[model samples]
Target: MAIPLSWWLTVAAALFAIGLYGVLSRRNAIGVLLGIELMLNAANINLVAFWRFITPQALTGQVFAIFVIGIAAAEAAAGLAIIISAYRRRRTVVVDELDTMRW
Candidate 1:
């Protein structure tokens, strides 16, 4: 027996909510990036679950999930690079501490 779609959706929703809370509450740059990644994975879970339950024959959802994975990888790389550069210049990775442009 397969798992229900509602179960998948509930898991994804919970993951997304946790990620959102992390993104909003974390002050560290890396923590925020991790939260963003969590959100992306939650989206992927939802996409695959919908595709499995709603259109198992079609490959669209799998393809979209793959694309999202690629995008998330790229995003993580770029975000890390930015965070590293900011830390190098400022000696800190706290989001609020890197605000050099604040006038």
Candidate 2:
């Protein structure tokens, strides 16, 4: 079975758009982090799809995806730590309220 490139791109684009909206509209630090993660995942999906349909020679996409997953994990960990620290300092998780960060 084969999948169409257009369909895959469409799905990836939708996911990226949703992530962008989440990042733009959400006010919580965790929500923003989640949006960023979603955007990264969407990018990974597009990269894999392109490699599968267009390249089809090497497993570079898979390797790239693995690296992306690792990076995303690290990003999530760091983002969580920052969010927690911000919450501790500001007593709020709202993005707007984080303007004054005191460590």
TM-score, predicted candidate 1 vs. hidden true structure: 0.96
Residue-level lDDT tens digits of model 2 in 10-55: 9999999999999999999899988998899999999899888988
Alpha carbon lDDT at 21, candidate 2 = 92
TM-scores of the candidates are 0.96, 0.92
lDDT of 1 by residue, 1-44 (tens): 38899999999999999999999999999999999999999999
Worst 10 residues of 1 by lDDT: 1-10
Model 1 scores a C-alpha lDDT of 0.95
Q: Each candidate: what lDDT?
A: 0.95, 0.90
